[model samples]
Target: MELFFKYLQYEKRFSPHTITSYQTDLCQFQEYLKEVYDLEDISQADHAIIRSWVVTLVQKDLDSRTIHRKIASLRSFFRFLVQQGKLERNPTLRIKAPKLAKKLPAFIEEDAFTQLLDQSEFSADYKGFRERLILELLYGTGMRLAELTNLKLADIHLASSTLKVLGKGNKERILPLNTSLATSLSQYLVKRQEAFPNNNSPFLFVTDKEAPLYPKYVYRVVKKYMSSVSTAVKNSPHVLRHSFATHLLNRGADLGAIKDLLGHASLAATQVYTHNSIEKLKAVFEKAHPKA
Candidate 1:
C-alpha cells in the first residue's frame, strides 16, 4: 500500500483528496475480506471475492456512484499489482458494474442568479466582499469548488478579463471573465487588502483570520446565499457552475466553446448541457407552438 501511495503521489500525481479516497476504499475492502472470509492476503482476491464484496455494498444501501468508485479503486490496485508482477490477472476486469441512471445536472435560473447578485445586499465588510466574490467567480467562470479554493492572488488577470484556473489533474486552463465578474474581483481585492494589511496569505479567498477557506466553509457560504436566491432542489456551489454553463448554452454559446470554458476534457462531457437546453425548448414549445 505504501508503494501504491508513492506511485499515486510521485508518478501519477493524483491530488491529496483523490489519494485519500483510494486509500479508504482499499482499506475497507481488505477489512471486509479479513472479517468475512478470513482472507488475510489481498493478493489472493479473485473474481468471486470481488463480486461478493460488491454485493455486500449493495446490501448496505450505498449510492451506486459510490459503489462504482470503490470498484474503480480495486481495479486500479489490481492493475498496479499486475504491473509489479505480483498478480497474473486483474479480477475486477471480469466484474460488471451496476447500471447507473443519467440524472440531469441541476442548475439555477438566470433570473434567480441575476437577482441574487444585483438586488441582494451583502454586508459592507470584508466577509461580505469575499462571499460575493465566491458566488460571482463560481457562476461567472464556471469553475469547480476545488479550483476556486486552489486559486491564488496571481491567478486573476482582471485587466484582460480572464483567470488562469488550475483544474482537475493539475491541468491549467484559461477562463474569461465578464465585466461584472471582473468588477466584483476588483472590488474584493481592495477590501481584502484593507481587511488584512499584514496578511501575506497567497490564497485568493480567505477567512477573517487570513487563512485559506476550507471546503466546508466555502460550502456553507455558498449554500446560505444560494438558499436566499433560489429554490432549486439542490443548492451548492456546483449548482451555480451548472447554471453558468446552462445559461451560456441557452444564449447561443457554442457547445465546444462552453466545453472549453468549463474546462471539460471531452465533448461527451459537455453534451449534458444540451439536454438541459432541450428541456427548456420543450417547455417553450408547449406554451407557444400553434399545434398543441
Candidate 2:
C-alpha cells in the first residue's frame, strides 16, 4: 500500500490533497474488509467484496458523487496492484457507483464581476492589493485553487504578458495575461515588496506574515469581496473560475481555446461551461421574443 502511495505521489504527480483523499478512501475500505469479512489483504478481495462495500456507502446515504469518487479510488488501487503483480485480477471491475445528476457549474454574472472589480473600492495597503490581485488572477486566468496556491514569483512574465501555470499532473501551460491584469499584477509586486522589505519569499502571493498563500486565506478574501457584488450562494474562488470561462464563451471564444486556458485534460471538462452559456441564451430569448 505504501509503495502504491509512492507511485501515486512520485509517478502520477498527483497533488498532496488528492493523494490524501485516495489514502483515506483506501484505508476506509481496508477497515471495512477487516471488520466485516476478516480479510487481511485487499489484493485477495474479489469483485463481490468490493461491491458490498459500495452498497454500504449507498446505505449511508452518501451523495452519488462522493460514492463514485470512493469507487474510483478502489478501481485505481486494484488496477495498480494488478500491474505490480500483487493481484491476478482487479476486484473493482464489476463495482458500479450510483449515477450523478447533470448539474451546470455555478458562475457569477459578468456584471457582478465588473462591479466587484471596477466599482468596488479596495484599500491602498498591501493587504488590499493582495486581495484585488487574487480576484483578478482567478477570474482572469480561470486557474484552479491548487494552481493559484502553488504559484511562485518566477511564474509571472509581465513583460510578455503571460503566466506559467503548473496544472494537475504537473503539466505546465502558459496563459496569456490581459494588459490590465498584467498591470495589476505588476503593481501588486511593488506592494508586496514594500510590505516585506527585508523578507524573501519565492511565492507570488503571501500572507501578511510573509508566508505563502494558503487555501483558506484565498477563500476568505474571495468570499468577502464577492458577497458585496454577487448574491450567488457559492461565492468562492471556483465560481470566479467558472465566471471567467462562461463570460469568455458568451463573448464568442472558441471551445478549444477555453479548454487550453482552463488547463482541462479533455474537451469534455471544458464543455460544462457551454451549458451556462446556453442558459444565458435561453434567458435572453425568453425576455426578447415576441411570442409569450
Candidate 3:
C-alpha cells in the first residue's frame, strides 16, 4: 500500500489532496472488509467481495458520486497489484459504480455576487482587504480552492495583469486579470505588506497571523461573506467559481475560451455551464415570447 501511495505521489504526479482521498478510500474499504468478512488481506478479495462492499455503501446511503470514487480507488489499486504480479486478476474488474444523475452546478446569481462585492461592507483594514481579495481572485480567475491556497506572491504579474496558477497534475495556466480585479489585487498587496512588514511569507494570501491559508479557513471566509447576498444552499468557494464561468457564458464568451480560463482538461467539463445558459434562455423565452 505504501509502495502504491508512493507511485501515485511520484510516478502518477497526483496532487496531495487527490492522494489523500485515495488513501482515505482504501483505508475505509480495508476497515470494512476487516469488520464484515474478517479479511485481513485486501489483495485476496475477489469480485464478489468487492461487489458486496459496493452494496454495503449503497445501503449506507452514501452519495453515488462518492461511492463511484471509492470504487475507482479500488479499481486503481487492484490494477496496480495485478501489474505487479501480486494478483492474477483484478477484483474490481467486474465491479460497477452507481450511475450519477445529471445535476447542474450551483452558482450565485450575478446580481447577488455584485451586491456581495460592492455593497457588502468589509472592515476598513487589512482583514477587509484580504477578504475582498479572496472573493475577487476566486470569481475573477475561476481557479480551484487548492490552486488559490497554493498561490504564491511570485505568481502574480502586476505589470502584465496575469496570474500563473498551478492546477491539477501540476499543470500551469495563466489567467488574465480584469482591470478592476487587478486594481483590487494591487491595493491588497500594499495592505498585506503593511499588515506584515517583517513577515516574508511567499503565498499571495495568508492568515491574519501571517501564515499560509488553509482550506477550512478559506471555506469559512467564503461562507460568511456569501451568506449575506446569496440564499443558495451552498455558498462555498466553488460556487464562486461556478458563478465565474456561468456569468462569462451568459455574457456570450466562447466555450473554448472559458475552458482555458477555468483550466479544464477538456471541453466536456466546460460544457456544463452551457446548461445554465440554456436555463437562462428558457426563462427569457417563456417571459418575452408571444406564443406561450
How far residue 116's Cα lies from its native spot in candidate 2, in Å, is 1.6
* Per-residue lDDT of model 3, residues 1-292, tens digit only: 9999999999999999999999999999899889999999899788888899899999999999999999999999999999999999887887878999788999988888788887889997999998899999999899999999999999999999999999988899999999999999999999998989997889998888888989998899899999999888988999999999999999999999999999899999999999999999999999999995
The number of clashing residue pairs in each candidate reads: 0, 0, 0
State in Å the error of residue 55, model 2: 1.8
Task: Sort by lDDT, best first.
Answer: 3, 2, 1
For model 1, how does the per-residue alpha-carbon lDDT over 8-124 read when each residue is reduced to its tens digit? 988998877899999999999999999998988888888999999999999998988899999999999999999999999999998887887688889988899888877778999
User: Which stretches in model 2 have alpha-carbon errors above 4 Å?
Assistant: 118-121
Q: Which scores greater on lDDT, model 1 or model 2?
A: 2
> Which wins on TM-score, candidate 1 or candidate 2?
1
Which has the better lDDT: candidate 2, or candidate 3? 3
Instruction: Return the top candidate by TM-score.
Output: 3
Alpha carbon lDDT at 221, candidate 1? 84
Candidate 1 structure, TM-score to reference = 0.96
**TM-score for each candidate, following the candidate numbering:** 0.96, 0.94, 0.98
Clashing pairs in 3: none
What is the Å distance of residue 126 in model 1 from its true position?
0.5
